[model samples]
Target: MTDMIERSNTPVRRRSPGDPPTVPNHPVGPGRLRVPLLMFGAVAVLVWIGIWIGNTQLTHDAFFPSRPGIAGGTWFEGWQRWDAYWYRTIVREGYVSYPGVQSSVAYWPSYPLLVRSVSWAFPSIFITGSMVTLACGAGAAVALRRWVGEFLPRSAAITTLALFLVYPFGYYLYGAVYADALFVAATIGAFLLVERDRPGWAGVVGIVATAARPAGMVVAVALLLRVIERRNLARAACSPDAAAPGPFARFDPRALRRRDTPVLLAFAGVGAWSTYLWVRFGDPLLFATVEENWGQGAGPATWFKVRVFEELRDKPLAAGTIGHVVQGLLLIGALALVPRIIRRFGWAYGLFTLGVVGLALVGTKDFQSGGRYLIGAFPCFAALAEPLVSRPPLRAVLLMLSLVALFAMAVAYGRGTYLA
Candidate 1:
């Protein structure tokens, strides 16, 4: 009995430095990615089908419609809801400012510009936009799998990918005419590039990411943290007896090389936009000004307007109240995982998650679109998936809940409900 007990406690084998890395317990090569990609594709199709069914079978609420150039009488038109209307407006009539009022300038330019570029060949901005989103979503999934696979086992990586795809607002990744997919793709791509020691390429991708959304500047900051972390790791390696640097350790200026300068390019997209806005509208920060018109801005009043408690008190079971509650819960849960994320992935990922969640919370009223915004903080999903990889029953319950929420949100979005 003693011999058997000792044998059962043996450690798993570890690969030597010279050997090619293998998926933990799997011994597979690059082909391990194939199954995850296929799973992502399958989920995308299911989300698309759910949207189509909801749009065709249910009655849509009265809401703003897409502009003339992109509107059409087709199933695809169902996707041209909510913010897609604003994007179509920008595509048809370039960003125009209306004093102290909501305007096209409030929407970022990268997504609409991509849609217009694609429309040159497709002739339908709606279809072009959806195609762009789907392509970006695919890119995001691939990068996410690769990034997680770098540290965790194959099972953990796949679990992270699955949770991200089925996340409540994840249906937006399935060809919704929104910038979320593109922003996610570029952000994850940049992180993956940074992980691979290609900071210059990461900055290039950062340009697209920053231009895609207001919260994109966080990518630049995250990259900076990663660079600093890498530098500290190198220093520690060279001095075996020296104490390892903490995540927030101070760095030497001399350590920064020419290769690090390109990280500055991460700010180029937003810089160019600011320059354009200054020249065209006479206010470089017109986007922030425009955001105020949409009932979003920083201050105590904005926090009060979140109305989470008020909604629950007034109508706890109402759909709007329920949505707000779920959004609040998700925001709290993501923030709660920040420490774990930082501990597991290092300072870059932990702080990136914090920045994303902070931006989502700071200027919003009622946490509108909070869940959707959390999609950019992909590390939270990784933090959640890592432990679950060893617990099948708990994983199943979480995935099931996520699937139900994903479908519910997709259907509501397709039916033209004002879901963020």
Candidate 2:
């Protein structure tokens, strides 16, 4: 992933045939990150204030009433809606279940566990969870910028970060007390570690990712694809003439060497959760089973029965219809970038985008939570940023639209209205 960039006014130095290949001095230091970090911090602050104002001043009929003791005690209580309630519950009382009912098991454990760990000091699940989400969101921004910088110019990386920040549903990454912020941080951090050729650390991060959400499994699969790519590159380097292995080439056990074994740890994260469920509830895969209680079941039957378009046609301006449209457009846009992402980044990223979109589609009935889920498909944003880097007007328009939608969604979320 390393590329050499010659500085302007620096003289070119020719290398001898025997000279070692020049290694790049790619230091991702404060000097390189100052502007983007400040910009991200500013946007985060604005989002916090915006949500506070919306929750305080604006009023709407709450589609889903805030749960008791879940939201509405503080200025930032607007963020403690929907899934935040589940996380807060989990923090107060560990995963509990009633027969044939939706339970805390449906929500993954890492984020709640983290919130609980810090709750001793913060003393408020809502505040502690919001702080964790904010911290993870900042980490995601940094990791995204540095990862994009590996292949693209600094301006392009900054644009990508900007795009991520204003990405419509990106408010979830700001002050929302949801697991998504941690999931994105872990997912991108793992990708960056893999790009830096640190599989062990990547696996460790993947553990956090997998423990954050069910979609976190995509990180493990993407890392496996990257591992295969590494093997193919190594083979090409060794043979020089032999054709590289096909993308679907037969599995080679030799590829799973000591360095690569850490990838198994990704599954271990989820595996541990399953074991806990088995011991506590006598069902190891209770998470998947409980999803049916939420009207989400994954299968070919589910895919064929999608009614998003029908909903749009019948009630074009309904809140749920609008959510469907926004998520549908984002899914289409991401799908459109799959090929370009593979060409620009790698197979892992392109396919990871596909996997994320696929999961979002199949995992929901009316694309519920689809928009929030697609935030994990960071590759699509990078692919978009590349072209936008040379088109300022287009970039501005996109950002404007994104910001408008972001504020609208923030207000909706603050009002306890269901939003993806």
Candidate 3:
């Protein structure tokens, strides 16, 4: 509650001249942006409607999280299946049964810890957490738009956000209170920091983001990128003799002195989180065992069982269902478009993509929706925008159709329906 409530309790008085802007307030300008802006607004409305629908239908009368063969407090409200339920327990009570039989359920902390802190300041932490999740998704979109804008023409940037809003899988972020929103925001924010040459900031965000669901593993790529960039510069400057030094090597120690900080940060971040895994339960290496005791092993047979059985083996119709099939296709389309986005920005965001792909693999089973598992790749919207509307009248027509599909998908997603 501290994290969410503290911000809300602070009244939104008009900013003082000395104050910094709270958010990306101010319209994205007028004419060329009008349609996209309208579409973004529609995205917001549909998300609210989705929450309303979920609150009305999904709130449990006595929703207890049942960890097999273990006895404890179970029921929470609103968030009951998949990661959310276990997370709620983690927030309420610290960490337990983690490294032993229930190891698979001991998540990375961070988000649940934030939830616990926020619950302290709120009347109903459940509702507050859900809203916080929603806000996180919206915030991520803004950060993503800013980062993408660096490469895209202004209109394309705005269009990128619009496309994200109406993406067939986009609705999942708001459909249930999941980590997808926070992960998206954090991963994109990390990219923005790296793009701005703030590797330190990028590293910190990566640590926190990955803590949410171990999805922040993608952020490590950003750190790796910094290391690679430094190596490239040093290699170009190195000479054949005299300790293999070159012109700048004899004088400037800028790239050489602390060339490995980013790499160390990467290890520190992953190691620190891995340490949390050990400290909380025991075996720092084993991420989650609760999911495993109930049969979440990563062996070929278990993997085959999940792939063949295809339904929610662990929980209800959460991530481990046919829902994942549709989501996978959506992810495929998103990945295919990444190269175009990198070209537009003249930057390589492969590390971010790597993290997304890695986390998707770690999911043990398919994730709930497109927005949940792979959408956090961050650059995909910008990439997707290109294939449809790169040029003129015909492209514009394609863009219009995409916009229609986008909004329609947003609405349909909110309604929780699927077309075969």
Error of 2 at 352 (Å): 1.4
Q: Ten-residue segment with the worst summed lDDT in candidate 1?
A: 15-24
Selected candidate, larger lDDT, 1 vs 3: 1
Using TM-score as the measure, name the better of candidate 2 and candidate 3. 2
TM-score of each: 0.89, 0.88, 0.67
Across 200-276, the per-residue lDDT of candidate 3 in tens digits comes to 67767777676666655556655455434434334443422223222233223344335345533534555776787
Give residue 205's lDDT in candidate 2 (0 to 100). Answer: 91
lDDT of 1 by residue, 1-420 (tens): 999998777653433111122442332576555766787788887787777766777777777343334344435766878888789889998999998788998888888888888888765788888889888888898889887776677788889999999998998888889999999999998887777778899899999999888888888887777766766666555554555565446244455678788877889988988899999999998988888888776667677664677777889899888877778788889999998886777767778888999888876778889989999999999899989988999999999998988887777787788777
Candidate 3 local lDDT, residue 364? 46
Model 1 TM: 0.89
lDDT of 2 by residue, 1-420 (tens): 123444444453432111112342233567556765787788887687777666666674465443445433646677877788888889888889887778889999999998988887775788898889988998898888877777777778788889999888999888798999999999998878877778888889999998888888788888777766665555444553455455554134465568887876777778888899999999998998898788676665457535776776788798778777767777877889998887777666778889999888777777678889988999888899989989999999999888887877777677777777
Give the winner by lDDT: 1
Once superposed on the true structure, which residue ranges of model 1 sit more than 4 Å away at CA?
Answer: 1-33, 64-74, 250-254
Model 1, residue 122: C-alpha shift (Å): 2.0
Those runs of model 2 whose alpha carbons end farther than 4 Å from true positions after fitting are 1-27, 63-74, 238-245, 249-256, 299-301, 305-310
